[model samples]
Target: MQSKVTTTKEKYPDKPITFIVPFGAGGAMDLVARILEKSAVKHLGQPLVIINKPGSAGTLGWNELVTSAPDGYTIGISASELFLHPLYGTSRYNYPTALEPLAQISSTPVIMVVKADQPWQNATDLIAYAKEHPGELKFGHSGVGSIPHVVGETFSKSANITLSQVPFRSAAEAVTALLGEHIQIVFINPGTVKEYVKSGMLKTLAVADANHLVDPVFANALTFKEQGLELFYGNQFGVVAPKEMPADIRARLITGLDAMINDPDFKKDIEAMGLQYEYLDTKQMQTQWIFENKKLTNAVQESGVVELIKSQKQ
Candidate 1:
């Protein structure tokens, strides 16, 4: 019988791999995909060609990915939207079951921020002010069902406060609202707010991670855990192929991704982009997908976010 390694070699031989990014070019996920392509080709012996398919909050690209041939030639960069979108009834594919987990590439925490002139100084103060004026303070997020939306909802539930939610087309737009004082707060990626924070236009209330981010701009910010909330929310980027991919091909892809994720240069480049290089093998990635889906489903159901999201879509 031919070994798995030999089988993968025979399958690919020299055909270039098609990599799909479920987002537009120049996003963090796209950058990660491109960074890995540089080193992954060296290990897999096939160049990775990136194709961006952005729309419907990444569901369009995900549909393209799961519907593609499961020959290991087409793979996509999966994000938190993989789980959130399905729960919101926006995606047709049941992500955890439809996609074969190859490997987890990177993860980044959501940083909650407010304009520098806001009265609240920390999460505790923010929660207090929110509780005292429930449904009065408004927060902005990238979209109705995005990670930031879920994080804001989860935070409100944990603190027993009700803050109005406003969804925008992107994080940059949400930040603009915050800067204009149109919103009291916003949850955004650390990298997006780093410049504003540096210019003293915004102040970070807390990061939704167990520990503060390592980036100098957010290194001093406290975490939700430190503030006595067991809240952690962030975006995870990974690679996935159709569920029926050949075992040998899946193994080969996982091996190449693992090697690229662990490379020193890869780590530096990812961190520079305000993303942490954390590698999870196939098994771990599968477990994470299941766990995250359950958590997100519960949060959306309990918070009535699903109804809110559906209303927004109409």
Candidate 2:
């Protein structure tokens, strides 16, 4: 009897691809997804549907992505919290085994800002006040385990000050509280506060980055490192799929996304939105995921945020 031969054929993305944004509409993640949808659809030969599942510090959408079938039709725009969530004990699945990276889209560094009339002029003055009045200064962040929260905690550890934390539903909300004088400080992306900074409603004390930002709005602001605090923080956005996706399908998705990242119109839109356009292939993104996972794990542990989170829950 002759044995039957078998061959695996590739059929992918015949229908609309669902791109999950783990945040509400009008946020950075949502904006990124909407901006790329047209170009990505054109490149992939299918419509890219954006589904917002905002909650659990961005893990809700990630959970949706990981739980979906590994068919390359369902993917998500993930942020740094995807890795930090598991460290904070908020997620059941970890990054390494739960998701597969497709491409890194962009990154926006966090900026430390205060109300325009606040007394502190720069990072030095703020740190000095915080050091002298530990537990008196209130800093606002989007959520407990969000990148801005981690940035605040990291600043506390690096600067040796004990500042109080105030969590809001989103960065915009936190900035609103800051504007109302409900909070003394807020760590947020420049884009969210760009108009306010330009309008003189907010003062950017320093950026939590290693290098100076290219955005003209922050040209005069110094980095936290420049201010003598060895600290850096930012939000990195990327695409991820369910683990064990077919190799050919993953390659197709990556190719389409890579093209979208390099498109002139897409780049212009991202810059206009005050985001830095940076692209990383699948391999590079995987390396970044691992490196960031380790780096943030240490930061979270050392900052004692894990304990703080547990206490808050209690």
Candidate 3:
């Protein structure tokens, strides 16, 4: 049998590797990619270059990765929204079977959050109060088909509430809207705003993980299950390469990734950044990716996002 990875490694023993990031700088995805940049260099023996191709909700980079030569040299950082974006954007790119997973780094629970100064004390209070008010409660998201919007919608439908949903352009903008009291609740990454929670600016009501939110600050909050609701979901982040890459090369890449995730220093870096570190190497990543792909489909069907994208197609 031919040694694909060995051949590629021998051919370009010192060539720098490229890691494509399909999101804007300063965003959570970008931050995680940059962190990996610091730790991945030693493993690859050459410098790691990150390319930002933020458009079509991360489909542009996915498209680029699919078309690029799969010699184990090029890979992309794929995240939650990318799995669902093409279904909402008029993009011609998507989960082409051409992409292969190297590993999954971590998972973050979508937390229903409100300003610390807000009147609602927990998810129960928020849901109950909204039941009476209906459409009076407002929430913010990155946009119409964003994860936050979908989470809020699912939460509302499951909780039997009608909170209004608002869309923003970026997480920073969403945070501003939340801080200015423009929206009553927001679904946000737990890591991005941990400081705000620590500083008492944002109060987390519930985490859409299980029936509980483990953080001490949220110990008093009520989860959907506790409130007699049945909805739970969040986001994940991982690395992927083209499926055509030789199996040997793919294995080496995943092995290196597994080592990275287990590195104490790397684990500390992600934790310090307020992001959770959940490793799902090769097999697990493949399973998780497939599951989330179905979710994106279901979300599109329920949200009419795929139809919206089709209508916008030129």
Candidate 4:
């Protein structure tokens, strides 16, 4: 049996692997997939063919991914949406259970930002104005089941403010709307708005992280906790396969992914795109998944994000 297993592993992945990206092309997720694809050829001895199946706040693609055969030929990228979609009835499977986590590639801390012309200078000013005006202020997010949406809602709840929540197909879209003055604020990844923030087109208010970002552009930014809200959220990107994938196959994929992420060129590419490189092995990724799952469960429930999603549909 052991020899057979070894032979099977050695001969596995004779064909190209389909990498399902649940978000649109030109987005952060797509970029990550492309970067991994470059490294896969070296480590896995097989090409990773990226397929974009973006829609329905990422559920459309993730649904297809979770239902794919567990033969190791089809794998997908996992983000906060993997765990979040289930909470709001947008997904068919619970994350970290329905899928096997291979490795964590990167983490992008969620940040609050406003148009440069907005009246609020910092989180304090924004929260104070929000308290005064209630739902009069509007904030845009990627989608109902995205990290930005959940973090935005949680921030609202923690600050006891009723800002009007706006949903866009992608974080880029939300940021665009913010620039057009269609919304007053946005909860997004700092890297996405780094250029705008530097050019004085957008202003970052607070980051939903324990420590301020080390990026010199945002090093001085304060955390939501420092602004008197206990909100801390981030966007974690990783690789996953169907839960029932054979242990041998899973091990092979993990080995490939671990090697791919550790590549110096891969790290450089991810950092160049403004994403923080924080690689976690399978075991560490699983532990982090559990912690994030519990925390997200509470954030979703306490922040009334489900109710918010339901109301949006209605």
lDDT of 3 by residue, 1-314 (tens): 46984565655525777888865566567778888888776765666688977654566778888888887778888777766666665555666366787888878777788898878877888878999997898988655555666678778776778877776655656778889988878887776677788789998887777745445555565666666665566778888887777666666677767777778888787776667778888888888888888877886687554665455333
- For residues 63-158, what per-residue lDDT tens digits would candidate 1 score against the true structure? 999999888789889888788887777789887789887889787889899999989889999999888887899999776778888788878878
RMSD (CA, Å), candidate 1 to true, equals 3.8
Runs of candidate 3 exceeding 4 Å displacement: 1-8, 11-13, 86-90, 131-134, 211-221, 295-314
Tally clashing residue pairs in candidate 1.
Answer: 0
Q: Which wins on lDDT, candidate 3 or candidate 4?
A: 4
* Backbone clashes under 3 angstroms, per model: 0, 0, 0, 0
Give the per-residue lDDT of model 2 (tens digit) for 128-188. Answer: 9988887889999877788988888878877888888998766777888999999999988
Q: How high a TM-score does candidate 2 get? A: 0.90
Clashing pairs in 2: none
- Pairs in clash, predicted candidate 4: none
**Model 1 stretches astray by more than 4 angstroms:** 1-15, 117-119, 125-138, 157-162, 176-184, 195-201, 228-230
> Who is ahead in TM-score, 2 or 4?
4
lDDT of 2 at 196: 88
Off by over 4 Å in 4: 1-9
Best-performing candidate as measured by TM-score: 4
